[model samples]
Each structure stands twice: as C-alpha cells, then as structure tokens.
Target chain A: MTAPDDTLLLIEDLTVSYGAVEAVRGIDLTVRRGEIVTLLGANGAGKSSTLNAIVGLAPRKARRMEFSGSDLQGVPPETVVRRGLTLVPEGRRVFSSLTVDENLMLGGAKHATRGDPAAVKADMLERFPILAERLHQNAGSLSGGEQQMLAIARALMSSPDLLLLDEPSLGLAPQVVDQIFDLIGSLRERGLTILLVEQNVAQSLEIADRGYVLANGRIELQGSAEELRASPEIQDAYLGA
Target chain B: MDIFLQQLLNALSLGGTYALLALGLAVVFSIIGLINFAHGELMTVTGYAICFALIWGLPFPLAVIAGLSVAMVAAFLMERVAFRPVRGASGTTLLLTSFAVSAILRVLFQNLISARPIPVSIPASLSGVLTVGPLHLGMIQLISIIVTLVMLLGLNLFLHRTMAGRAMRAAAEDFAVLRLMGLRANSVVATAFVISGLLAGVAGLLWVAQRGSVDPLMGALPVLKAFIAAIIGGLGSLSGAVAGGFLLGFIEVILQAYLPESLLPYRDAFAILVVIAVLLFRPQGLLARKTLVKL
Candidate 1:
C-alpha cells in the first residue's frame, strides 16, 4: 500500500492553451508512487495536451505543478526528462532513419550520469527480444506493434521514475494491444509509476489502480478501477455500452 | 596529359571548397529547415579574421586557427541573436531573416573594414608548385584536396560513432522526438552551427590562399554556387550536398576547359541550366532518401 505522501506527480488548476484554443482548463490531477493511473477521454479531450503540458511541450498555466516534491513549473522538456520524467509521445515518433540500437542509445543518453547506459540498454533489449534481434535495422522498418514496443523500450532506457505513455494502443492489433497492456502491468510490478492516457477503456480500467475521466478539458469523473468500471456514465461513454 | 592532370586537380580543389560550404549549409538546414542565406557570411568572417591576424604579425598557421575560431563564434552569435528569435516562423520569414543578416554583415564589413579588396600576402611556399613526374600541382590546390578528404573522413567518424553526432542525425529526422529523448534542442542546433562555421572557415582559408586577396563580396558568387550545388544534391542531405558540390565542380571545370571562348562567359549559365535539367528529372536530387514523416 502506498503512503498518503507518496505522490510522484501533483498538479492543481493546470491550464494548457494553444493561441486562442484552450485544450486543458484548470484541471487537478495526481499520480502516486508505484501506481498505474489512467487518464481517459475522447479525442481532443485534452489528454495529450495534459501530458504535453507536464513535459513542457504545450503552453501552460498552473497554480501548482510539482513532481517528487520539486517545483516543475518552468522546467523545459529536456530538463524534465533529466529529472526522471519520460514521455512516450503520441504517434510513437521514433527516429525513422536511425538504427534500433542507435535509437536505444539515444534514449539512454540522459542516464549517462545516473547509471551504466550500456547495462540499462542491455536490460531493455532483454525485455524486448524482438528489438535485440533487429538492432541494426532502421526503426521505420518495424511493424506498428513492434514500433510501439520499441517506443516503450526506448523510454525505459532513461530509467524514469514516472513514465507517461500517450495512446500506446492507438493503432495496434487487438492481440498486440493486449500484449502492450501486459507489458505496462509488468513495468508497474517492477515499481515504475505510470500515467497512461488511453482510449481503450475496458482494458485500461482492468489494469489501472485509479482513473480520471476528462471531458471538455475538465475531469468529469474519478474513482477506483472497480468503481469506474461499474459507473454507468463511464460504461456508456467510453466502454460503448 | 599535363593539361588533363592540371584540370583534374583544379576540379578536385574547386569542388572540395563547394562541398565544404554546401555541407555547412545542409547541416543547419537538415535540423531546423532553415536555408540560412547568411552561411556565406561565415566565410567572410573567416576572411576578415585572417586579415586581422596577419596584420597582428601572427604566423600563417596561427592566423588560420584564429580565422576558424572567429568563424565559429560568429556562427554561434548569428544563431542566438538573429535566427533564434524567428525560429518556428514561416519559411519565408526565416529566409528573409537570413538575407537581412547577410546584408547587415556585408554592410558592417564594408564600413568596418574596406569596401575594396584587401590583398593578403601568403607565405611564398603556399603558392609554390609541386612537380611529380610530368605533372605540376599548386601547393594550395594539393592541400585543399587533402584537407577536404580528411574533413570528410572525420565527419563520417563523428556521425557514426559519437553520441552527439548520432543525436544530430536523429535531429535531422525528427527533432521534436529527439528533445523528448532528453537531448537539448538548443545544444543540438548550436552544434550544427559550430560545425558549419568550421567548414566555412576551412573553405575561406583555401579560397583566400588561391585568390591571394579578400573582398567583402568574394563569398557571394562562390556561396551562390554552393547553394545551387546543395539544391542539385537535394537540400538537407549531407552526402547529396557533397556529391552535388563535386558534380558542380566537374561541370565548371569541363566547361572551362572545353567550351568555346565565345561561350566561356556563359559557363555559369550552362551550369545552372544543367542543374535545372537534373531537378526536372530527379527533383529530389541524387541521394535524397524518401522520408515518410508519419504524422
């Protein structure tokens, strides 16, 4: 059981905007240490924007945004990553021209000061055996499912304390999606806190300890997995009841 | 046979200079998508630095190093002050900003130094000829070719072996994602500028050594040719830039050697016409890999 003060990421009244378009409007959220927290919403429902804002990719305003007891308000994305927060962004934007090994090495570059990069990479490749088998091939040659796996593996190379996964199952086969969720579960079991943003409501609830349903840039509902799974509103809107 | 050998040497030396400048331009462009028209100004910066160093009675090798250092500093300042503000602006805006910078630098050079050409006296040995069997090669030309090859080999090693180099290659493909992977965007862009500046510095030294003079506008015609060569090889492709530079060099040399005297004046025009023909066919240049940027 996690302690009350074991919060890994904490945000309050965080607002993200793009020019005149407000994507996330004054939302409060939290992710405790070593827990899989899911943020579920429809497309353009500010899920990606929330993740982007946290990583400093989107223009943001917030009353409070703290990570691991440190202020994360004005930190740039690069610095944010170095502080042990990693985001696997939407679309799995791997360096398509670079070899898989090269991609993995780049991912581990931030950890040069933190740990043995080669050992971290070796461990990552062990977790994703398919990647080790095709280490020299360009990342673009990988199938969509395989690419998603590579993306996750690449993020793990940083040994981040909190990993933000954005739509990891967006365009994968059903079986592949199951495998990705299983991997997420395994990663959680290894003590990595995850903030997963997904549209796969049924599976996400199954694995998530708690969830927040965001709509029109606001959290519409929040509950434990069992409570959210039984909520009629969640069942109707996301589970396609 | 002697004429052929001399012309071959000329082509290689001239092409080497063009390749250096084009690669410089392509490095920054590949990462940021900015066709920095002020790239030539870096060469001009080196030329002026060399002039000052020589005046300070610095030895020839030291002067060259001074020039390279100045060029690199100039590139850093250019990126920070001029380009950084207009970053993420429209393509036209970026192009205009580069032009504005080029114009400003040229004006500064004219006013601060001299509008007229300044003759730079090189060590007598640099202008000497190297005789091998029945052939004679200008010392400067031989040095240019060797230096160019060495630079290319060094660049190859950097790109393939180092983390920073791989980060640059990755930046060229997907810059945003690279930042997500923990590489600082500013540092990567700065590295590109520094490399380009170094190349421009080398090219400038060779150019001044060959011409025996430095002028504010000397970089204009050569840089235009380099820009054209970069386009011919496909913009943003480093290997293509080098290949395009060599090809452009060969075209000019062949034309200079073979074209009728009456047509000699039109050689550049013919070269441009050839470039157009190539673009009409390949469009992507000689070695541009098809980039399917998945949205």
Candidate 2:
C-alpha cells in the first residue's frame, strides 16, 4: 500500500549490519499517524534489529529514514528520543535500582516539548495504579508484568508522538500478556502511534491495523491485518490452522 | 572519657575526609565503570591552585574558590582530552589512562611548581582547639566533620531531588537505557566528573588544612585510603562509600588511641587486616546490592 501523507515514520531500503552480518537487509516500512503496525517475525528474523536501527541504536544505512518528516539517519539515539520517538527496549531495561517514582521521573526528565513533567507523571500514576502503589519501591522488586507496565508507563512519561515497543510481552504470563496487549490497544486509542515488534503472532495480528512478516532480514509479506489473518500462508505457518 | 571523646571526634573528622574522596571516586566509577586512579590528582590540582592563589595575594576564601574552580575545569578537560577518546574501551584501558594522566600532571607540578612540599599558612583560628564541655576538638577536625556532613547532605538531596542527579543514578545502572530516556551520555558522564572534582576540592582543602602543607604526592595516601574505603563499602554504591570511609577512619583512630606506642607505627597494617576480615565475611563489600538478572 502507498504511504499516506499522514505517515509519521517512513523507511525505504533500510539496512542494519553488525560487523560481517546484516540483520535487516534493505526493507521498506511505514507507520502512519495513529496506527498500530506490528512487525512480526520468528527468532533471528531481524525484528529487534529493525527497531534498534530506527532509534540509531544499531549501525544502519538507508536511502530514506524519516520520522515526523525529519531525517532520522545519523541522529544520535538521545536526539532521536527528543524528536518524539521513544523505545521501550527489549527486556524492559528500567533502572532496577531506582524506585518506580524515580524511573518515571527520569523518563519525563527530558520530556522534549511535552507538558509539565509533574503533570505527565501524575497522568502515568493515575493510568497505572499498580505503579502508584509501588512508587517508592525499587523497580527490581516488581514482577515481570509490573516491570513491563512500569517500562511502558515510563516511556509514555516522555510524551512521545511515536512509541516503539520491542517485545513488551516477552517473558510475561499469558494473562499479563493479554493485559499488555490491551494496554497497547488503549494507548493507540489515546492517539499515540506505536510500532510494535512482537513474537506473539496471533495477539499482535489481532490488534495491528497492518502487519509485516519478516524472514531472514527481509520483508516476506505485507498486508492488512484482516487479509494476513485470512491468508493460507499465515494460517499454515503461524495460526496452526 | 575526654580522650575517648577526642578520638571519636578525630575519627569523625578523618572519616569525613575519606568519605568525601571515596564518594568522589564512587561517583565517577558508578556511572561509567572507570576506576579513576587519577582522582587523587584532582586533589593535587586543587591543592596547587589554592597554594598559587595564596602566593598571588588572593584572600583565603577567594583562593579556595579559585582552587575549586580550577579543579572543576581540570576535570572537564581531563574527560574531553584523555578519557573521552578512550571511552567504551576496556576497563583496564580507562584505569591506565587515568594513571597516565595522574603521572603527567604530577610531573608537570613537580617540574614547574616545586618538588618540595609548599607550606600554606592559614589563619591561627583554623589551627586552634575548640573546647566543648569536657572535650577538646581541633579546628581542622571540626571543620572537616561539619563540611563532610553538609556535602553528603547536599549530594544526597541532589541525587534524589534533581533530574540531572537522577539521570546519573539511572546511567549507573544502564547507560543505553538512560540514552533512550532522551538524556545525552556526554552530559551525564561530564556531570559525574564535575561533581567528583567538586568533592575532591572539598576533600583536598580538608587534607591540606590538617597537614599545613601541600605536596605533589600529598593526595597519594588519602586517595589510596579512599579507594580502599570505597571497596569496603561497595565501590559503586554512594552510601557504601560513605559508610566505608567512616568505618576506615574509626578503625585508624581507634587503633592509634588503643594500640601500644610501638604498635602505632604498624596501625595501617591492622586497618588492612580489618578490611581483609570484612571482605572475607561479606565479599561483596558491606553495602553492594546484588544485581538481579531479568528473566
């Protein structure tokens, strides 16, 4: 599908390599404004690399990589974040020593061009009551699901226009996974665009407006969620039909 | 009782100096995993700055300000010139870089300034004794204790209260994650160095006041002691550094007070023994938090 003018992130012929190995080999992707786009792939399929490359975490080369109509190539990771693209890195790399409140505070510490940090923190606390209950407790003390929530809440604290979630449901309990997916859906409803990378194929497909299937560091397929869900190739490979 | 009170005050004051220097070391180490052996040189820099300021006819307070300012600027330059180029290299490389910087600065001071210890005269009031009830307190000791506590309190508030400080704390845990939070790595690491420099300034002043002289190698013994204190308290942990410093001070002063005069010459040996015993028992230092692996 042609990218609409409202596209928030645009990537064309993007390549990510670490030394001799290429993780993402020349793939084009787009995330339009206010849409949930899931980039789904199996292990070693360059899913994480794609997300990392977007934020300048990985060595990347691209013909065009734009976020909010601005070139993202060569921008430092921190500057990319200030440009309103925040990543909840794989494994929810929260400052475990810091208390929940401190994590949220650090998240909003550089809330570039956003509302008052105090207000953003209050909004996060209100949305994630569990985080509020354990505001003073170290983030390490939290369970996997709770830490994930705190990680997402912390990302939201930045008030980013585009939120990149990398395997938010990884290592979470099944019920907790449901809660995270629900949270992602709710965030989209609140007008925050998300580019999700997940291994949970079925659930991601359910919530994603469009889906891209990556294989061996390249896009193998791309279509609407409904069409991909109905496709024989998806059902045979992933849906267990 | 009076003797005990005197020793207690001495311990507090001495411990305060160690705490200040150790916390300085810990601050830099925690954020970037660099065991900056040159941290002692920062003290040396401050001491020389103060000495030069005095020689140049500046008032004591103004000299102190000049000393601290030079130390801060020196620290900034140290990072930008030496450390930044070798950043992200192995820990050993960073440690070696610090040693090289230390040696270079010391040689420069020895050749250009004076190889001999430069005596810095202070007001008589700073050297006088204070009588509080039945106890006598050395002026230097009292000031050291007070300044150490105040600096600790200020640092504590900065870490817990300010965004920059919180960013430092976070960077200590996960640097990449800190960048993802929209804070620059250069700024955070630079801030750590500047804070450490300020701490070294306070600590160097105290050390110089007690000695009445500043030498090129004056920082050597105190910084070594501070390093041991930081390790005993848990190297990267700030509170641990303070606790370790105080503990080391108490051990040294108590040893001096209680040991036979003949054994006093070997006091540091006994202190080392105590540190060895503590490490044998805890291994992780007294206050290091176990890093939990995320599943």
Candidate 3:
C-alpha cells in the first residue's frame, strides 16, 4: 500500500454512461507511484469503460479525479496523454495504413512538447526488435503478437508516467501471453506505474501488486494480489479448479 | 506527329489541373470524410480575386498571390462557420451542409457581382505559343504541368516526413485514437483544409487562365469532374485521387482529339461512360485498400 501523498492517480465515485446505458457505475480506485494494479473482470464487466473514463475517452463524471496532483475533470484525452498518462486501447488499434515507423512517430507526437522524439523512437526500435525489422511495413501486415508489441511500444514512446493498458493479452497464444506478461513485469521493474485491465484473471493476479474484480459495472472485490488469489469466490468464478 | 505531340502536352496540362483539384477534395475527405461540395466555391472565390486584382492593374504574379490568399481565407471561413459546428455528423448531414454552403456562395457571388462571364487578361508572354523543333507549346500549359508536379512532390514529402502530416494520416485512419495521441483535432482539420484550399487556388488559376474568363458558374464543371475523379481514384486515397484525375483528363482529351466529327458532340457522355465502367469493375476504387473498422 502507498501513502496518500504518493498516489499517482486518485478517483472517487467515477461513473461512465453511453446515453442511458450505464457502462461503469460509481467506482473508486487508486494507484500509487510504481505500483502495478490489475482490474480483472469478464466481458461487459466495465473494466474497459473504467480505463476509458480515466483516459477521458468516455463521458465520465466523478466526485474527484486527479492524476499527478492535477484535476482531470473535463480534460480532453489528448491533454490527458500530454500530462503523462497514456492508454494502449484494446485489440491493438494500430493505424493499419501507416507504416510501423509512422505509427510510432504518432505515438511520440505529444512528447514533442518536452523531449526528443528521435531519441525516444530509437529506444523503441531497440526495445521492440520485431518492430525494427518491420519498420517500413504497413502496420496491418504485422502478425497479431507483433502488433501487440508495437501497440505497447507505441504507448511507451510518450514516456508516460502512468500507463493504462486494456486487454493487452486479449487474443494471443499462451507463449505470447507469457511474453506479454513478462514485458509488463519488466515495465514495472523499470519503475513505471501501470493500471491494467484484463480478463485473464489468474495470470493478471500473479504479477499485480493489488487486484480489483468488477462485475456488472461495480467492484465486487478488492484486495492485495495474494488475498484475491486465495479467495474461494475468485477461484470458483474466475479461476477453474 | 507534331499534332500528336501538341495534343499530348494539352492532355498533360489538363490532367495536372484536374489532379490538383481532385487531390484537394481527397485530402478533406480522408480526414473528416466530408466530400465538401462547397470546395468548388473556393475556386470561385479565387477567380473573383484574380479578376479584381488584374482590374486594379496589379502585376500578374501579385494577382495570383491575392487570389490564392483569398481562397485560403474563404476555406478557413467555411470550416469555421459551416462545417465546424457540424463536426462528427453523419455523411448525409455533412454532404447536405456542404451543398447548402455551395448554393449560398454561388448566389452570393451572383448577386454581388455579375452573372455574366467576366473576361480576364493574361500577359501575352503567358498566353503566347513557344516554338521548338517542329512543335508548338503553350507557355501556360508547360507552367501548369511543372507547378503541379512540384506541389505534388512537396505534399508527398510533407505527408511522409513531417509529424503534423503523420498526425493527419493517422487521423484519417482513426480520429478517436489520434486524439489520444495528444494532437489538437482542430489543428489537424485546419491543416487539411488549408492544403485543400491551396490546391484549389492554384488549380483554379490554371483553369481560369485556359478559359480566359471568370464567372460564378465557372467552378461547376471542374468541381464536378474532380469529384468524379476522387470517386474513381478511391475517395480517400491521395495518390488514387491524382491517378483518377489524370485518367479522367486523358479520357476527355483523347476522345476530343480523335473522335469522328459525328461523335464529338457526345464527348462528355463518353468520358463519363468510361468512368462508370471503371467504377463497376473496381467498386472500392483503383487504389483503395481494405480498411478495418474497430469495434
């Protein structure tokens, strides 16, 4: 657990809706500096919606929402990214027509305000060797696993302080999933904070510092990773015997 | 052979102008998915500016600059007053809004100026023919082709090498995702419109030079042909739009040059028939790639 002053993101009673259909009801969550917090839920459990609201992609209302000591009320998504928070949206939404290099270039566009994009791009290419090999190829032509790596690498181009990842392993082979989770663990080891939304509950809890389980737009359980992993309710509902 | 060479030059010049116009429309379409029927009015605005500048005895180059500037301003205004308010509306709404803007501008020009064609004076040096080795070439035709080529090269570099240009391309692919990249949507949209206006201005200048006159309705045919070119090229592809423009120009020029006198009267109809045939064969367009829409 982190001290109150060290909290990187603080949200209270956050609600998201699509017209009259409430996707995420009032929920409070917090993440401190250098913590990996996993949000686990089934389809339509509003895990994605919570992440979307945090990044300002969805219409959201909250009693209070702050990131890095700044208010996020009505802040646009782009501004949210500029403020050192970025989202790697579900399904690896790479710009299909653009080249891998070009997609990475766009990811670092916000970094232009504060850092050297060329240096960051070189770092990304080095980190994701597969992306470097296919730098000039169209993003759509990349394999699913490669695309996922590119998506994660693209988000890192911004040098975000807190990363929001939605379903990073939504569709990958077991080995690829292992590789992705390894990458996530490595990212945390490098001192970056992450708020992860995943349906792979067991794998997610294995690496998460803390876990929250949401059902029907509300958080049904919240505890340290060890506590959630040992809970009978979590075992029967999410983990198979 | 000399006559053939002359016709080839004519076709190239006409094709360059059409390509420019089509490319302008394509740029806007790729970004906002708006066909911008009012894009033609931008040409009309430039045409009138050129007329006024020349009538005031300004130099031809100055007149061209004035025309381009006015067209750019008109484009900005159109986006601000008309299109911006309706951003994210359905395709039908945007299309009808652009049509409304077009109609209102045409009527405004008509009521403000004269409905009659106003003659424009080009320097003798520009309109005169240059002779070289058994072939005669119009100076304006050579200039238009060279200018269009240079503009296209510059645009290609901008789109490929620059960050803003990359942002625009990404916006075309997924606008919502682009916003998450921390780019101002308004700036990207404005850049697209500015480039569109610049192309319209230059193409309009070349077109008016060829016709030797300006009128409120002057934009009607060129815009219609450019729109057809955009459709034929694959509505949202930049290079496709250029290819479509050249193809349309080639069909029009070829039919005019070689058709029997009896068939010459149906030249426009024949050109459109060719376009329809092409569309029938490749419905997405000549250069269109499949786009994946995310859930």
Compare the candidates by DockQ and give the number of the best one: 2
Residue pair clashes in candidate 2: none
Per-residue accuracy of model 3 over B1-295 as CA lDDT, tens digit each? 8878777878888988989999999999998999988888899889899999999999999999999999888888889899999988899999999999999999998999988989889888888888888777789988998989998999899988898888888887788788878888898898899889989999999988888889998888899999999999999889999999888988898899999999999999999999999999999889874654332
lDDT of 1 by residue, A18-48 (tens): 8899999999999999999999999999999
Off by over 4 Å in 1: A1-4, A110-113, B1-8, B130-136, B289-295
Top-down lDDT ranking: 2, 1, 3
The C-alpha local distance difference test score for the whole of candidate 2 amounts to 0.91
Residue B242 local lDDT, model 3:
96
Ten consecutive residues with minimal summed lDDT in candidate 1 chain A? A110-119
CAPRI grade, predicted model 1:
acceptable
- TM-score of every prediction relative to native: 0.92, 0.92, 0.92
Maximum-lDDT candidate: 2
* Ranked candidates (DockQ, high to low): 2, 3, 1
